[model samples]
Target: MEVLALLCIVSVAFTGLTRGAGLLPDGPLNAAVGEEVMFTTTLAPTEIPFISVAWTFGDKPIITSNVENLTEPEYEGRITFFTSTGYLQLRNLSFNDSGEYRVTIVPRGEQQKTGTTRLDIYAPVSNVVVASNTTDLAEFNSTVRLSCSSSGSSLSVLWLNGSSEVTESDRVQLTDGNFTLTILNVSRFDQGPFRCHVFNPVSNGTSDPVNLSISLSVSNVVVASNTTDLAEFNSTVRLSCSSSGSSLSVLWLNGSSEVTESDRVQLTDGNFTLTILNVSRFDQGPFRCHVFNPVSNGTSDPVNLSISYGPENINLTKSPSQEYFEEGTDISLICSAVSRPAALFYWFLNGDKLSDTGSELRLMNIQISHSGNYSCQAFNPRTLRDETSQPSVVSVLERISGSSVTPSTNLPIEGKSVNLSCEAAGSGSRMWMKDGSYLILADNIALYDNNRVLSFRPLTKTDSGEYSCNISNPVSSDGASYNMVVNYGPENVQIAGPSEIRVGETLTLTCSAESTPSARYNWTLDGAEIHNSSVFTKDNTGLSDSSNYTCHAMNNITGRTSSAVHELSVTAIPAQTSGCSAGCIAGIVVACVVVCAAAAAAGGGYYIYTRKKRAKSTGDEGQDNTAYSGSQELNYADLMSFQSKDGVTVQLGSQNNSSKDARDRVDNSRPATSSPPTYDVHMQRMRSAAQPDANGAQIYAQIRNS
Candidate 1:
């Protein structure tokens, strides 16, 4: 007994040692970046001061305890341990240090034991920003710059446009981490908001986006002329620049650089003035007035300088205020302007500049395409800038036949009225002119109806005309002549049939028109020749043989026609079945016949016996058969009765009779076809199939009959 007790205690101790290994004292260890943490173990007296202190990440030892080498790039300054202290310390922790660190102690001949600690590092995110110049509307092509930046350690910067990151190009420049975005030459295409974001491994943050708009503004310096128009090669030009304020320091650039003195170019008090000794095409180009002002350091819109060439005294004479041009006819525009240096001659249609040797712009053979907003800009070398006249709208009028003006081409009854209107191609404003000349006072036409509207109220034949509508404004005038045909037909015409009717009875058709002078009515069947069908005669009545009718009305003077169509139906009684041929005798015969019918009722009793055998042999059960116990038989009887009353006999055969019956012809003449042979056959089949034969007698009967 004493030996057994000692053995049991030993066994218990072995069990605990095997099961509880590495369970306690193995919890996860944690630390953060740039911080020092240590793990320690005990040592015996006289233990070598150089005892191994193994360093590792997870299960892999980055530095073996036996190597004793400390000056490695990855672990050099990041880790350290004292010989006597029996402690391991990690310094300046980084992201790579975020893992398990373990050390093994192997004091001479003793079993080795191990312990672990984990290191974690956290670093903050970098910064970002978006930048653009602050202004709208710059010159067509020029240089501009945008920039982005961030503030963080070991930083990286990214540039974003909307949602995508953009790369740098020759015209687009980017800096190191500074993220400077440059647009070499700015145009309308380079307008948008830019965003900047800042992030690092530790944390992330972003900056607000900078919105930019670009536009065009006159440069600091420009040349102008006191005279209305500039002449070619000979004109006095005045040069000017900002005398003070923001653009005061702006320097003038001629062509591409600062304007210095040439024989023809002179500057008085820094006001740029250029005198062309001889006016020629070589001097015509864009002149630059560059401003070096610190406040407005960027480039300004360049001023274009040109020489004048066009007909002189370019005056336009138009009657009917705004004259409508007709193609293939002669029309003229007299351009005239006085000049110290007589202007060269050219002609233009619309804004299209045309060249001519003489002073007048004449179209000997005009065309429809020539119609447009026409204006003239004149310039000469003596004048600094060109002058442009107000635009004149020239319409090439070509009248074609079959052009009619009505309030509407298609209109709903009672929804539209006959209002004759003028379709004139000119400014939409209207004014009155008597016959051909002199303006009519505003009072002559009703204020509500002032816009060339000829309303026909109870319209008469005299309303038609060649009336003219004249439109004018201070700048121009126009006129339109129209032949107003006051046309209207029967409106709100109703042809109602009699409400009460007997089968094959006739109904009267009354055609009434709610129109002026009561439009004349003509009746027709379908869409055939019309007939008056005298009012006293009952010719428009609805009869059994009559087709659908239509009533048309026409206005005699206006010659406008309108019609309404209506379906005429005669009433008749539906056919009901007479009593069955033999009354109750037939019904009794049908019932008796059903009692002896062949039945194909389901074999639930057999299904139950078979199911039981299957369940017993398989050692399982699915369900018990329950049939023909309640309403099933009644359902079978009801189905037979319905088939009897409807005279439908259902029969069973090798080939389904249902498929064959579906191909039978349908009787269109009679509402119902002749009755099938008898309902007795269907009833007999139902009754005979309802009974069960224990010996399969029905199968034997079918075989014998076949």
Candidate 2:
């Protein structure tokens, strides 16, 4: 009956439906495989009665209900309907059941209503697989093509490296609806356990892991030596080889022959080392090393070995093998050795190192001090080894050419003796020669000590000559000569000076003598020693200096003396006089006498008058005046008498009557005058002494009296 009602409802169109009923899904009707879906219908209030409810799948009935539910044969166990609410439920849906589903309602008194909705179903993805074109990858030299597959539709595939999505880059490509991943020029960085992820709207799945491995090739093989390959004998050395790869196998070779480990040879660092112990000459050659792997192989360049030895068999040779050499001759010595490397030479003299380095040693202008036992040493610088040679004896002979002749004294006196000695070396016979001839002894000549000493009693002019000493030996003969000199005394003595000289003139006299040795001179005047020099000078010559000057030259060497005399005459200078003559002095004396006489007469008259006046003024003195005047006259007489005797004038005066007596007591007392004397009295005295009869004293007396 419910099916009949659904068919009747689907055949009859419900027109002019008044907002009475509707249908809606509880959630989206899109479904996945094995998921359930529900469709519900709603009714509005109306004056109608509920008749039936039905659900269909793409024009086919899925379920119907009036009072109970009924299902189609296709959805018999999968579909159900609610009787009170008119809701439909589909269980375990699949993609084939995807279509439009409808719900219809029939009312008894109102218009019937029908509603529709869509149903979408999808299957869950499963059984995913990700595969690569190649599993074994060579880094940077290969490509990989990866594909992802699944059993679901409308799916998305993604590549993942250990849970991280692989991004698309220049080395990665995607194709075929994200089902394929292509990796171009893959490197070691691309190595991974990769997986493919497939997803759909309802479910997702991951493929099994695909592990990628990169194969790296071996390259850049290099070999090195720990120390310098130049090894000395009995020394050890090591060589090493290296490469840039994994799982490496190393091999060593010596000149194309494989080298194996032995007691003295070792391999270390996984067969990469070649160690040679106590190296010998046989171990010196080219060596090689090889490195290989499963991917590639490499060979190292050859390493050459060097070995060194010692210096041995040292020998020394001299250029001249003679017994002896001259003191000033040049000589050479050479040294050699048998060594692997050329040796350095060192010279030694008398077991002392000379600090010289060379193969040959040269001595220039050798002296007697250079004589010694000489030797040399040969050394190897690299091996630090040396060898010494035997010493050689050197003798420097004293030849006869070294003989000499010597004089006992350089300077010989004329009457003194001298000796000439001859000297020679090596017990040689000697002889004396004078002036290149054999000496024949004369009267005063003598020879002693096998003619080596020639003596002269007195050295004379004949004794001065070249004396030669000759030496004759069994090995050599030579001679040496000397010149002897004899000294003499002063000869040809002479004097030099001016024969005549004037007063106040300078005089120079030089005396010299000719002698082998210079002579000293002595000068004398009037037979008395005056100077002891060869030259004499006398300035301002006077008459007292006039004498016979004698010079004596004496030789200090021979003690001999000689003399010469030169007479020096000195002229006298006349006395100078003034213009005044003796006659003018006489006239001056006469004038002085006349003035004195007048002064005396005037003084006498004045005295007489003064005495008279004094007597008249005092009253009773006329008689006294006569007496005083008379006494004054007597005093004047005495003064005139003394003046005439002594050639000097005097004056008198009286303070009282006793003045005349005082005047007589002082006879020498006289008054001085302001004027100079008319004539010099001391000169007058000299003239009077010189000429006793000239009357100079008498004239002075006359002038004083006057």
Q: Give the CA lDDT, 0 to 100, for residue 380 in model 1.
A: 46
Query: lDDT (0-100) at residue 85 of candidate 2?
Result: 56
Backbone clash count, each prediction separately: 57, 0
lDDT of 1 by residue, 1-706 (tens): 6577456534533442321132113324444456665654333223354446566677665555544644346676666665553466777776677766666654443355555554545555544555555444354555556666655444466666666675787676777554677666555556555666555545456666665454444343444433323445565444454422232344556467566556666666545344444333434435555544332343445555565543234454433245576567666665455553655444555667766534456667767787787665554445443445566677775543222234533221232345556455434456433345543333222323556665444344444345566655443456666554444456677777754453324457777765544588888876675567413124323234345678887766445677776665654433222122333223333433343342222111100000001011112222221232232111111111112223343322122333323322122232322222224533444454323332233323332242
The TM-scores, one per candidate, come to 0.25, 0.30
For model 2 the local lDDT of residue 377 reads 91
Cα miss at 390, model 1 (Å)? 15
The list of candidate 1 runs beyond 4 A from truth reads: 1-120, 128-468, 471-483, 486-493, 501-509, 512-518, 523-550, 555-706
Model 2 spans > 4 angstroms off = 1-22, 26-28, 40-51, 105-114, 161-164, 221-241, 245-706
Query: How far in Å is the alpha carbon of 358 misplaced in model 2?
Result: 65
Q: On residues 64-166, what C-alpha lDDT tens digit does candidate 2 reach at each position?
A: 7666667778887886666555667889888788877777877665465677777778787989998788877667878988888898767888889887999
